[model samples]
Target: AANDLLSKAKLDASPDKVTLVIDPLIDGVTGSQSVATHLEEKRVIELVKSSYPRFQVARFSAESVAKSPIVLIGTFTAINNAGAATGPRDAYRICLALADLKTRTIISKGVARALPDGIDPTPVAFFAESPVFAKDASTDAYIKSCQGTKVGDTIDQAYADRIVVASLINDGIEAYDAGHYRDALDVYQAALKTPGGEQLRVLNGIYLANYKLHHTKAAMDAFGKVIDYGLKSDKLAVKFLFKPGSTQFSTDRSVRAPYDAWLEKISERTAAKQGCLEIVGNTSATGLPAINDRLSGLRADYVKDRLEDNEHSLRGRLIATGKGSREMIVGTGKDDASDALDRRVEFKTAKCAI
Candidate 1:
């Protein structure tokens, strides 16, 4: 894939004076880094250094700002079989490009498709610890920037608008990954005040950082803002894991520990909106369709009951439904943490159900 991408880029035009800096690649769908993306970034860098020295490689840093380097950005998305059915095999498409940091205009871009034979989609440390689905306006902007961006055209306007804070956001993520929660919080809080820095990553980072610092009230407050952002977008999907063959919440600390905090925040945000809500449940591909449908419905009902119990305003405004394995984001059927998103319970605004 690296070779294919290189062949398409314009690095050979002036092998003597081309310099490119490597920006960390991200998963286009989630606008976050992953193990797979890191590996791909390294692979692309090594290939450029060893095979194509015409383009000098550089690191993305403060010291390198004067070099006025072309930044290489990358994104990948999973391509599943057509329709709602799972295909025999799944493929992934990776896109790489070098863009002028100042102009946000693409200089060169290439794409490659390959089978997910051994790719790891597990998110980086910060994202793995995130409790809710973080896809939002920022993520949509990132995805748009990755797909169909022409060589001379600028990237997505929304993403370009927030490009100035990308470096600080990366710093916060790195700090969080290194267990410097306080430092991460400082960076995120500072970024939140920057123009175009109020992206999902900044908001979610603030919540996670405060939560990690044991600032319960502050964490809840920050989390409430995150919830509000998500609810307003109508794309909130909390990860709710269940016990083996049952609708009970998982007893595992990783699963049950922050369950209440998430529920409470969701309840608080939803009640303030005073809108009809639908609690939709889904399962992984490991279970039978018939049985999974019934189980999913039961789980949705359980969440609906919990929400109603949490806030009185949600009593008759909630409805529960299930889709079994019908709508999967990652249809690996592994039924493990890798596919946990498939088993999520989502909250969507709906018309009041009498």
Candidate 2:
């Protein structure tokens, strides 16, 4: 089973590098919560790294995976209280696929499950096994045969619902990129109706779409939702474009006025929620790493000062940091409007203790 899977994955020649793309695994019951999916991805990556010492590993992004093979890991189903009489318990069925980006075909596929022991039926008692392939069967046939085995006691009804929401989110992003604010808003609204609709990414899209359409109240409301959630991973882009090699905001009044308005709204919202924030500054890949890092740090400090000025109560709740050009969303490095997103500030909510 192992040899066949590797052969199908085209790792027979032992490629020097591979990209790992692990999508967030949705809780089958909640549809929005991740079911230890990130941990699973990390385990797999560690296994690969230890098994293949010569191969370099990189995180998979849409752009980065286009030129290489990708190992895709995700969970399709999860069940809570599987085989349990009364306590809280859960299990997940995960799928792994190796796809050849050049051919756009899934070269190999397998599935595994975390199942509770009938006698124990506790979360800790749940055992997960490595994927296996059927002997003397083709890759497609093995995959089909493995799909028939069922062990979990409860089935996830909302398993496929998240995919619909994901599709809508993608469509909204495409619309926004095409300058169709109204269309993007419509798509975001539709996504909000589905299971897991209140995800941070979805809310961010709604806020951005509303802002673009000049719906100030709606945008602020959406932004408030984001603050209320307070997930540290969520980031809202602040289009505070800076002059090349300068830490100051653009000199144009027209450009500066809108950003000033945005800052005011952000300050009001943060103060109202008593929320702590992380002001992250970024730059386009146009200069030396040391210079970019310094400039980005200064820009973040500038934003922090402005926010505190707008709302003095936020003085101790904000932190300023810089990532330089190392984390550019667009790697073009062009210091222009087209690469403006790469040269902007981001506001990330700080995680609060329960």
Candidate 3:
């Protein structure tokens, strides 16, 4: 399947003038880099080198983009009705696009269907650790670039507009993964100064990096901005990991210990608006459905308590609810970091709260 796609993309750019850099493929629905997508990306890159040796594609690097460049961008979509006969495993629809950065046009496109082959859909380190629901305008734009049955006839506007900023964001992610929190903070700061940089990932990256560095003030400010962005979009999901099987936080001193500050910001921001809020708590699908439901409610009430504590005015304006495992983002049910996003507290604006 990879060979079939790469055969169409013109990876053979002039070696001296243009570099062929392959942007990492991402999950179409979630806009996350995953184990499956990473493996597929590796397979496709290898095919570009081994099967089509004549092509001049460079390994991705900061130096590669110094000259004029053409980029390979792609998405792997795992759907419920994958049409593959693998029992419960998901099949994938793969799309690969080649865009010329110099002309801002997608010159070639290819697609293939993937059979269910034990692909791991777990998100990568940075995405799994991120504290907020990631899907937003920027995510929607990127997802748009990867959609459609026929591409390459025109420029992929969403993907094209973001290639440059995406590079900086990737750098920041790498630095964060390597425990260079300060460096990651600086990189995201630099991205914030760029033209197309006010993205969810960029903003969330700033908040996470600051939180890790113990820069409480900066973290709170960035977090407030993240909530503002979410509020504008009308929903916000925050990952507030708790102690096992309980609404209480972990005993670990520093883990999720900033609840007070977090609630202060959440209250400060939400109270400034006219509408009430529905605080919904969700749990991973690890335990019995009944217990999970009750536990999720407890968690939501726990958050509500803290929020109302931070601001007395919110006592009646906020309501607590729970969905348990009914609505899951990851749905993996591993109950670890892999499914952490499943256990989140969401704040949705409400016209009236009872």
Candidate 4:
């Protein structure tokens, strides 16, 4: 199927450049998992690159997409065979689309099934008669055809290292979500040892895990790394839950008390590093947009004031902005624990004259 799509995309001339964009895969059960998406995307890129060696292929980025044709890969569904009692067994429905940026149209598109680990023929056959798996046979054939080359053999060691790091980070998050702070901390530390592991996600995991374990000094140090890396990657978001529709923080004593300590640590670290900071505020989608916008700004100002009060040097180095409910990490807007992540204060490094 992949080859068919490529053939249909008939190159009048060898593409000078091709960008591969793999959208995050949609898991049938768990919705969207970034780690899984990234891994799958890498796999798709490797496969496409191996198949189309004539074109110069690169990972899609905003800067690269404007000047090249893009091969967009997305997994529509991933279903795990519950009846299979043994090793990993899953099937994925994936879509491949080629878009010509110059022509502004999708040149070729096809859907292919992907079985990462082989599935049990017995269960597959049994389900084959069912409505869901009725089309499985043809899909499986397409999947086999789409296997351009063995991914493990084609991908570079550096890319493999990134996959390892991302996997560990995902494991850490799962552990953290399950309230296993010590385990999560160990996993995050392990990830940090691998190449390409010194990332925002890994550092943030380390900080959260340390904080949960009451390792104040270690958490502080991790937070410093988070700040440094976050500056470069622009991916860090500090949690600051507030009372409903007000600037006052939530009265969760454990979280509230430690937040002050975090501010002090951040202040000292920023001052020592001579870093200018931008305090950006966000809110849950629970209120009027105008009201939320105003309240978010006030919250950012409040954080800036607190930081300035903690470290006088920060007074002239801080700027505050509000995004209201525009950039929610969680968009449920339930006004509960689930929605808490939406209300956050992010610290971004700002450029300033020395």
Candidate 5:
């Protein structure tokens, strides 16, 4: 229907130039890549090179795709994490990310069918002659490709987990905003107990709530969980920013432990994996660009020094980097301390590949 409207208005582009972006390929680079990647590397690229190919198809890095004029996205409707039913949250996140690319038009196979409770199914615009692959292999093909079903099931299950986590967070936040501190605590606690509870986020929220309610010890305990869980995952980093130019960590000690624990964990992991560790630094959007950059690097270096000197690692794996305030989790535009969230050090485990 949208295409028809575009054609009637003569606004659609010539079919030959339309391009598509598919899902990220996670299969090992050597494996028969997943359909999404295979189409881009083999089929789409072929079309692009085949003769102006009238219509070009390609798989692009997410960054490139986001900047492309036209893009078609292909995704299998994930049934469940176990690969049973299509997932709602995962699909929405994928679509939302693509929408971020600012493509003039986006067409989905829309196969997963259902959007989560809050997602609206507004149609996106697309250029002429672009076709998005949305259909499942015939039901028979699905059955024959035993692994196909597995793939679908996994997608759905991942979605389910994402939704579960999101929903819990939403409930907690809503309770907090409504001034129901006890209720918010209850919701957060319940979420933490759920099987796929967002351990880190929940702990963070619980700490914040306890802080607000004057439950200092409870807040500290909750903060400890954030530190513990964050330490367990290399990608998770504990960040602490100073107040503007000050060197002190957050006056809130509860806030410091999680980030500190994460750095300590990285030191421990790196010592075990590579006998050494590298710390990267980033800055929030606060100070001058040059100063922030320098400061960020220094902050990372500072963490490395602390870890190298004090951590229990046998090899004392640690390094420092300063990335001044450029990368803010939440923007630094807020009037005060919220900006502090963005200023800090991040410790990452350097993978030592054999």
Candidate 6:
């Protein structure tokens, strides 16, 4: 694709002059015997001669080879060519070196898809192209640069959507883990407005931050988000946790109003995409044989029932389960209240047709 593009582009914008330089192939191959026996390979020399019948090529001199306007080096190592690595760094270094030797322009196949921001790599009409994804911001930048020249390449929309969703969820999880309830809420608010399965993960983080941390108003608002955004459809979407020996959350409700404001914004995106919510429950080991088991089960069920009450289609689609005293985020046993960190619930989007 690149070679074809370059060939057509160069014809319309011809340079003042173009020269060809060849690198010999590596190893004791067919040309090696001829080069050794005849002091020059007639067959290899003829191949170049026939390929470029119009252009004059310098014969048998390293100095003469270095003096050409354009040098042609093979993509791989060549024994007869006897050049160092033909990678991107090597190509750039070769160009810089040739610049010092009075070469005004360079034409090589070793150019990278993109160079760093400040380094001005001279444009030689050439072709090399690669795909870019949204998660890879660096590659996206490179693709954008290529598009500027080609007017044909465009960023993948689906990849961009996934990247935005994943980033928001990750940020929310980080904030909740750090014990910043309001901050976690803020992260989820930003995330919920985005699209994809990851938005459910962000909602799950918000639910745990509010319900397990004792932010009552925030918890209510988080629940409201589930209802308003129509996200209560995935089976493994929501989760919650609590302090040992008690059902109460671990946080204060000083920041509920701000959380509510954020929830309002997320509700707007739910109608745009037919999304479903899922809930996963977890618990910290802190109690007797039967109590913790039942608590974990009940906590998971509570989230399930809440979704049903919110008027989402519960026709055997919404799912819930208890992971009793397993999957500890923190090492503290069930008896420790400070282990309140371990008690939690997670909510997320499960699947969407779109």
User: Which structure among the candidates has the greatest lDDT?
Assistant: 1
What TM-score does structure 5 among the candidates reach?
0.45
**lDDT values, one for every candidate:** 0.77, 0.56, 0.76, 0.59, 0.43, 0.38
- Pairs with backbone N, CA or C atoms under 3 Å apart (clashes), candidate 1: none
Ranking by TM-score: 1, 3, 4, 2, 5, 6
Q: What is the lDDT of candidate 1?
A: 0.77
Q: Estimate, for each residue in 114-215, the C-alpha lDDT of model 5 and write its tens digit.
A: 333443221111100001111121212212222223211222333223334435655675567556778878878888777666544466668767767888
Worst 10 residues of 2 by lDDT: 124-133
Model 3 pairs in collision = none
Q: Over 4 Å off in model 1, which ranges?
A: 11-19, 54-56, 61-68, 81-89
Alpha carbon lDDT of residue 121, candidate 6? 23
Writing each residue's lDDT as its tens digit, candidate 4 over 201-302 gives 577678778877899899878877766655555334666777777787779664354667767877887888788988889997777989989999999999
- Candidate number that wins on TM-score, 2 or 6: 2
lDDT of 1 by residue, 28-136 (tens): 6666688888888888888898897777787665445346567777887776635334563377778887776666577777887877889987788777666667567
Cα error of candidate 4 at position 31, Å: 11
- For all candidates, what are the clash counts? 0, 0, 0, 0, 33, 36
What's the true lDDT of residue 310 in model 2? 99
lDDT at 75, model 6: 14
- Regions of model 3 farther than 4 Å from truth: 10-18, 59-68, 81-93, 102-105, 110-118, 252-257, 352-354
Better structure of 4 and 5 per TM-score: 4
What TM-score does structure 1 among the candidates reach? 0.90
Q: Which stretches of candidate 4 lie over 4 Å from their true place?
A: 1-160, 174-180, 253-257, 329-332
Scored against the true structure, residue 272 in model 4 reaches a CA lDDT of: 83
lDDT of 6 by residue, 1-354 (tens): 223222322221454434443332111111111112122223334654665443344432334434633322211111212233321222111100011112222221222222222322211110000000012232232232222222222323442334445445445554565566678677777766655543334544566667657877776665555444333332222212344455443344431223223323332333234444455566765566367667776776665665455444442444556676664443224233223334555445656433
What TM value does model 4 have? Answer: 0.55
